[model samples]
Target: MSLPPRRPRLPLRARWSAGLATAFALALATAAPAAGGKARAAEPPYEARLAPYYGQHLDWHPCGKPAPRPAAGRAAAARERGFSCAEVRVPLDYADPGGAEVRLSVARKPANGPGERLGSLLLNPGGPGGSAVDFLTGYAGEHYPEAVRARYDLVGVDPRGVGHSAPVHCLDGPAMDRWAATDLTPDDAAETAALRRSFHGFADACRSRTGELLGHVSTAEAARDLDLVRAVLGERRLDYVGASYGTYLGAAYAELFPRRVGRMVLDGAMDPSISSRRLNLDQTAGFETAFRAFLRDCARHEDCPLPAAHPAANRALAAFLHALDRAPLRTGDSTRKLTEAQATTGILAALYTEAAWPALRRALAAARSGDKDGTMLLSMSDAYYERGADGHYSPLMAANAAVNCLDAPAAFTGPAAVRAALPDFEKASPVFGRALAWTALTCADWPHRATGTPHRVTAPGAPPIVVVGTTRDPATPYRWARSLAAQLTSGHLLTYDGDGHTAYNRGSTCVDTALTTYLLTGTPPTPHTTCH
Candidate 1:
């Protein structure tokens, strides 16, 4: 969970594999001034400068053309649902209102009325790199609780440097393919060197291709952009539903503009107070927790691939991955072989949701049998990377690294730092520790210094925000949600005693009802509300 990491996205029944993509990145450094620190000091002029952006009208038009066949159906459905797209312009650097600007892409499905309209409900499906536009038109826009959708326009804005909003580009297909194959859990000094090169190369590529934009893509900036989008939509208060990293983004917005917060929901919430190193270690353990849950479920089935005993199962899985590292396995594709990194990624991906455990079992069994069925493992990894059949990748990974790296200082300064931390990491998860520890080195050579740091976000004046947590969520640990809820002045914790990356709409009626009720009526779940 380092290179080509997963930013949590809202899970959709039609796209579980894509939704469950999971990975980790760490940040550790001194705190920087808040996003609008000085600007707030000069409020009069600052507000005057931003007035132009806030006053601009949105010119919504038809969304882009639908793709062929299968995807066209979804596109047509979006159209029938009255989905529209627009762009909002915001300053690239809020500090300099007169400087360069960037356009954020927004998609909306207007309220389909049968009830009095309340206002817009902005949705973000994580991925500091996830395309909110896609999330809106493809899933949440139509699938959200009808009661909420009928009154609230479901809107999604692709944060700057993500998706259709001036996306960050780094490695091309071939280069990305090679980078993905690079061994992360190095076994020797030479291997460690190679691993370092891969990370440095990625950072260099991003700096070279994305230039100044890379430095401006931090989560703070994205939060400011969110405010701009909120104002442009003519919404006096920001009503948002953000998952995974989106939770952090939403939190930032609340911290920046507490008065404007309204009926916000942060599912699979992250603890902003933790350092990047702590975040990585916690996420590694989280995946281990998820994997154990998966193993327990798998053991109930006769076709389970690993040993039934937890220790044996863990050892067996580790052994299998090590085997792949030693000798890559052939998949259905002629040119590609399933490497340890990809296999690890695939395993973590499945651990995001219980629904994919059966598939993971099949994939592991096939790989162990040395059958072409191993391609399933590779496909899962590709999905986590958002890599398409044509070998091109969505800018998800590039933008994930860019935003994450800029959010805080690198977790590890270099290989030596990672090496020293290995024991603690290995203790976190025997299987994932070393790899995740090494992943902390990914941003060591990033061109820009981090603009923000790990700190508590206590949006003092914000209204009640429902913070949902899944007990065994792989990407965002359950404790993070607790921590986030505890940190916020008006945060309410909605506990879902279940598995998966997020809690809402994942078949927990208790979770869905509570969240939907809050969103529709501006009521937060009761404190310490637990749902099974």
Candidate 2:
């Protein structure tokens, strides 16, 4: 599925979430460009003036030490896999290359084995807002097959407004704590107004603190930046492995540089053709599918968290959510109560990967037992949201909103549109439907307009690209992968009939081998390669 909103994403309440950690954002927006807005004109042909950037060499240094992995492991894991951090200077606004320029933060883990280097394998884990720098060294660099690593240097770039690039700073911890806890499932006019105020405040904070950068963080610009990064790395064509939202970014790059696409793998593919509303609707359905799978798996296990679950897991889940909605659950930190929103988010976080299912079971059991810890619900929510131990929050969500709202037309015009859509959203997913419907409104108030349309990305002359989809992916749906693969001129579809947000290295040697072989040999999987 395309990481939409920000995805290819769900809405803000859904968030770049797949959490408050595993929460999938509310995928959203209605069709086409907004009323009274003009599409951005095609970029000027690559001009001579851009050579300074494309040709400039980056000064590399040891990547900076990450914040200690909060004793809680909420922050990214300690980046033990070493990589060189380099600064790439690219135009803040590509339309005006000579104007102000921003320095993008990039990291590289050089080839390890004794083999000819096959250029850099640029890596991104999606999020529009996901950090590629840490990803390059942490999970990716550490886990990529040794053979693939021997031939290609791993590269990561924190797109213009994300991570170490010109970071987007909005609200601080206290403000974000309130923002994250704002209830999307509003009951009364007062609650509705409060939620609106929260969305409004978030939008206002971003605009106030980073307005100059917000409008420019569009995926198109980020794609252009990707090209510059490619050229600067001395690679004539791009080789990439992008997941989740990264799939959309990778697809954009291929569309922009069809001729320069050497090898690409879009795991958890996103359909660039849909509107934000459709993205939300599809993701709602997608999550329900994943959640159902989780239910079956949990119910069969001896250690399943809910002994009384199943036969009707959806009803059980709904009841659980409703229980929290009635009264905030007490927590170890007396000051922090697990509100419905936080509880819902915590539950969603575990749905990202099956490995988290048991943990979810355990957390839920404690909460049901009325443990003051409120179980690990709040903790899991905090992890998915990237809440730090120091009470600070990363700018990921803020930047996620910035890029998402700018990339697509508004999914829900305002509260009324959302109210009307609730039934459909609920139909899509009884558990997550209502909250998701409300999040589509997050972008209706965005300050900028979209430059892209819901058009197919054929990448007409690009080299072969690998597009992956998991049958029961919780974030990007499997159909999106099928759709994206069909759209690309040389796209190869690799299906993992499995669960989780992504599929490359989760557990299937079948999927992993297919991907690494393609990356190493320049051979795409047969047009239709299904790995079960």
> Largest TM-score belongs to which candidate?
1
- Runs of candidate 2 with Cα error greater than 4 angstroms are 1-45, 65-82, 305-311, 370-373
lDDT of 1 by residue, 125-219 (tens): 87667777777877677677778888999998989998888899999998998888889799999999998898889989999999889889988
- Estimate, for each residue in 229-268, the C-alpha lDDT of model 2 and write its tens digit: 9889999989988887788888888877788888899998
Candidate 1: C-alpha RMSD to true structure equals: 3.1
What's the CA error at residue 42 for candidate 2, in Å?
A: 8.2
lDDT of all predictions: 0.79, 0.74
Listed per model in order, the count of residue pairs whose N, CA or C atoms clash below 3 Å is 2, 40
TM-score of each: 0.94, 0.90
Indicate the worst ten consecutive residues by lDDT in candidate 1: 24-33
